[model samples]
Target chain A: MNNPGMTEVLFSLILVAIAIAISRFWKINVEKDIAIGSVRSFVQLVAVGYALNFIFDLESVWLILVTLLVMALVGAQAASSRVTKIKSPFVLILFSILFGSFVTIGIMAFLNIITFEARYIIPLGGMIIGNSMNASALSMNRITSDISSNRLTVETALSLGKSWRESSALYFRDAVTTGMISILNSMKTVGLVALPGAMTGMILAGADPLDAVLLQIIVMYMILMAVAVTSVVVVELTVRQLFTVHHQLK
Target chain B: MGSPSLVVSHVSKIVDDKKILEDISYTFYPKNIYTILGPSGSGKSSLLRLLNRLDESSSGEIIFDGQTIDSYVVCELRKKIGYLFQTPYLFEKTVKDNFLFADNTVSNSQMLELLAQVHLSQKMLESSVEKLSVGEKQRVAFARMLLTKPKILLLDEPTSALDPSITEAFEQFIQKITIKENLTTIIVTHSPEQAMRFDQTGILIADGKIAESSDIKSLLENPQSDAGKRYKARELS
Candidate 1:
């Protein structure tokens, strides 16, 4: 399969033009956003492509790790910006996403399911970190909202001699489930509803359909594990912050 | 009636640089019922919250059973000094679940006995808490609290939702249990008549300070402080 040239890349702008045209027709006032978003994504992806080419050629493990950390930091910052209830949620979010992604990817490398090469680790690690970041943010938001709104329920349990963990256990479970619901639904209708990005990309790049399907399955399971671990870790850390050592809700 | 079961010595609670309670000092005795009467936002509930360490005090200390409340394990302290909110929050499920929530080791027989004391029927245990009336929920909450065998009971407008008949009967039940179980009962109420019903020691607080602390008869009948007189005349809350 031949790599796409500049002509093919320029042809994709027609889709953006159509989107802008629809926005104009509807008077949605989003034509500027669509134009800016298209330009920004093009620039970002081109930069990333060049950076990845450099790192792949160098094949330095330290450089790869630093790149991953930078990605995780960016993801954490993006996630934390969405959360308003808690103070300084960045450290906890970063820890959760890093731990979840590292553990899942490390296990796959250990099992030789994926090698520790730059090509495999960078892309796979990107997927793990990206998924884990969303899970962490979703769970953190869910637990904080749940606890604040249900002060009576939590304090009632506390006043009845239950510890902080016991008082907020229901909200903890709910937050974890909320974080996981998207991936769970994706798993249910992965192939039937729409082709997932990994598989579609592989198939589009001339890989065999069966091989693409197998890779997509692995990606699905990897995302599930990463999301589960990240969400649980985030909820655990968040709930601890909601209460004091004296078993009182903060 | 006995040595002090709980003591609030020079306690104050300041929130966001605003004083909610200030230099509050009081001694609570065992087997005695104390009515905490004040207008809305008078810090009556805040004072009770301090006793159980629900909210930290800005200054002063709370002593329960001869030890500072902080000295004991916090969960243990809360268990001993049980608090019931203005509207009883029953955990979703059957009535028995709430009992088990308080003290899982409580036997069915013990639960039945406590229910009888609170005038709840045996069949009510299997019923969902949502089906029970507000008065019944209060009793369930009260009985569940007793399962912990608290030395002190803090009731925050426990009967505000109940009708007159249930309020009178519940007040009697609280008084009877205070004597029978030797629990030091501190009830926060808005109505002066409710304080009169308790017919015991009364603490009248206004603007975060205790305006009157005396027998129930003198507090409502012949209040000495201006705050108490204003409270009596329904001019201040």
Candidate 2:
């Protein structure tokens, strides 16, 4: 029999080689980061493979809860690092992801469209958490930069008897608009330019073509709600800290 | 009715283990243009910011119009005191939008009149702020600041980045606005010649403290100390 796994490994190696060559030609210092990230990804995926096998077998609700808790903590850490100067970024991340992902997951589960089993729960949770993390990071970074750069304008608004929220409305609008654009664009091109991961995974798992398409539709809808809600809410909360109690931007 | 236009009492600021200002006490009356003349890093800008409460004083108090600055809301205080930076910080929008900012109250006629006062035409309003020359941007910024109808104006080297002709135009505009509006103005500048133009009262700061406070021409003519002599040399040079 042909070693198909060997083909996958060889393909990955070639991709790495091409990445290195491009980096060298462009004088990019991403070589060390790429090497370390690849190694870490390998180790993490292997470890998670074993852990997930055990988790799937147990079929306990508590186990699923712990897994989601771990995901939240990791997502919070990632989001916080991107918007560093603000204190309590973890709180904003936690609130955003928990509200966004859980709401999406809850609605889908309640509809009985996707099974409440480990097989569906873990993957869906991962997708929701990952997308929400990206949205939160983008919105937070944009809002922070916006507030700092448009400081004079913000102060001008404040002087005009506007509240902090009113003063920062323009920035809040810009940041959330920027964060949602990617999701919106992907939505615009869905099923035309790209077959997203959920759809591809469902298809490879021997699911019917129509069934896979339906699941992908649900997942896309959930992602839209999660990304939009998470980005807007997180930015609103995080920007409150940029101002003093006296309504002044420090 | 008896309240002074602005009052700063015993204000001090310490940052990074360095004292920027210490026990600064002063009263500024209405309809007068005051110039803060100081060598670089002498905390003149810090003191000016203290009037509007932009920079917090570590100790002591600032009172404006018989009320403690701490008592007035920060936003309200800032609205009453307009601040203009050395470099024109125009937004990435049309000149008209930059003037209006988030303020919907400023009407088209008011903006046009303001532009005309600064020698800019209505045709320039629709142009992007980034496309304007530095002097034009400064004029736009000044017009924008005045739109709020601030009772006091704080200008930090308004013409520092301008060419001689533009600086002369800016100075003339300054004279017109201060006289017309009867606005209490505090200007921070390094040039003695420029300071003499609108400086009805002068305060010289050196080594993080006020070295002299007198009439602008008097301060220029009679050198009081080594610091004053240094400023005089700059003027002569």
DockQ, cand. 1 = 0.85
| lDDT per residue (tens digit) for residues A1-250 in model 2 | 2433746865787788788788888999798887788778878987997898999999988898789778978997888888766766888888888888878788888999777787778888898888899899889888988889888777656645467888889899988987788788998998899888988876777789799898888888888888888888888888887887777687
Poorly placed runs, candidate 1 (over 4 Å): none
Query: Each candidate: fraction of true contacts kept?
Result: 0.73, 0.34
C-alpha RMSD for every candidate: 1.1, 4.4
lDDT of 1 at B37: 89
- Could you tally the backbone clashes for each prediction? 0, 0
**Which regions of candidate 2 deviate over 4 angstroms?**
A1-60, A81-88, A110-117, A146-170, B162-173, B235-237
Q: TM-scores of all models?
A: 0.98, 0.84
lDDT of 2 by residue, B1-237 (tens): 245788887888999999999878888887778898988888988887777776678898887778888888787788788888777677668987877773568788888888898878889989988789888887888888787778899998988878887788878778777778878889999888888877578888887777788899888878687777777877322
What local lDDT does model 1 show for residue A166?
97
lDDT of model 1 at residue A219?
91
> What is the lDDT, from 0 to 100, of the residue A232 in candidate 2?
86
Name the top DockQ candidate. 1
